[model samples]
Target: MILDILMTFGSARKNEDDCQFNGYLEDYLQLLDNREEHLQVLFQKVVEKYPNARICVGLRFAINKEVVSNQIIGYKDAFKLEGKALIRSL
Candidate 1:
């Protein structure tokens, strides 16, 4: 079974956009903090459940640890970012 955790990242993006639209910079940053924590925990859970699970970093975020470089999944066609443009936009 293939598990797509990208949806979780998508939701966080949406939330950040909404917070920014409402002129809530603090709220957006706080949302990012929560998301970072969640992603860290989620990654741990995934690794525990699927010892050999493959993770695709479709979106970039900090998870406080190094992910196995060899397990990188490519999404060049789906996501194209120049430098830190995506993060700067947020």
Candidate 2:
């Protein structure tokens, strides 16, 4: 599993082409944010598509402490655990 995770990370490459397309660094930043959102939605879709296979979407979103707590431990999607519940909850 560590290898799988590492292999995924190893494949990441810089998207300098973003700067070329947007003509500014801010545009590149927006590209990164859009990419992040795409990844988030993709993970959610994957969980919906395959409920049996083990997977997780570990992401941190900025918000109030209450909201953080709710997403991090109060809901099933908190840790985005691979199964029906957070591993700790089980």
Report the number of clashing residue pairs per model. 0, 0
Best by TM-score: 1
What pairs collide in candidate 1?
none
- RMSDs, each prediction? 14.9, 17.3
Per-residue lDDT tens digits of candidate 1, residues 1-90?
234443333333455421122222333333345548865566566656765654333344432224534445553322354432333232
Candidate 2 local Cα displacement, residue 51, angstroms: 1.8
Candidate 1 TM-score, true structure as reference? 0.27
Give TM per candidate.
Answer: 0.27, 0.21
Instruction: Give me the runs in candidate 2 sitting further than 4 Å from their true place.
Output: 1-35, 56-90
| Tens-digit lDDT track of model 2 for 1-90 | 663542232111234211123122233233446548765565456556654433222211223335455435655344444332321111
Candidate 2 residue-pair clash tally: 0
Best by lDDT: 1
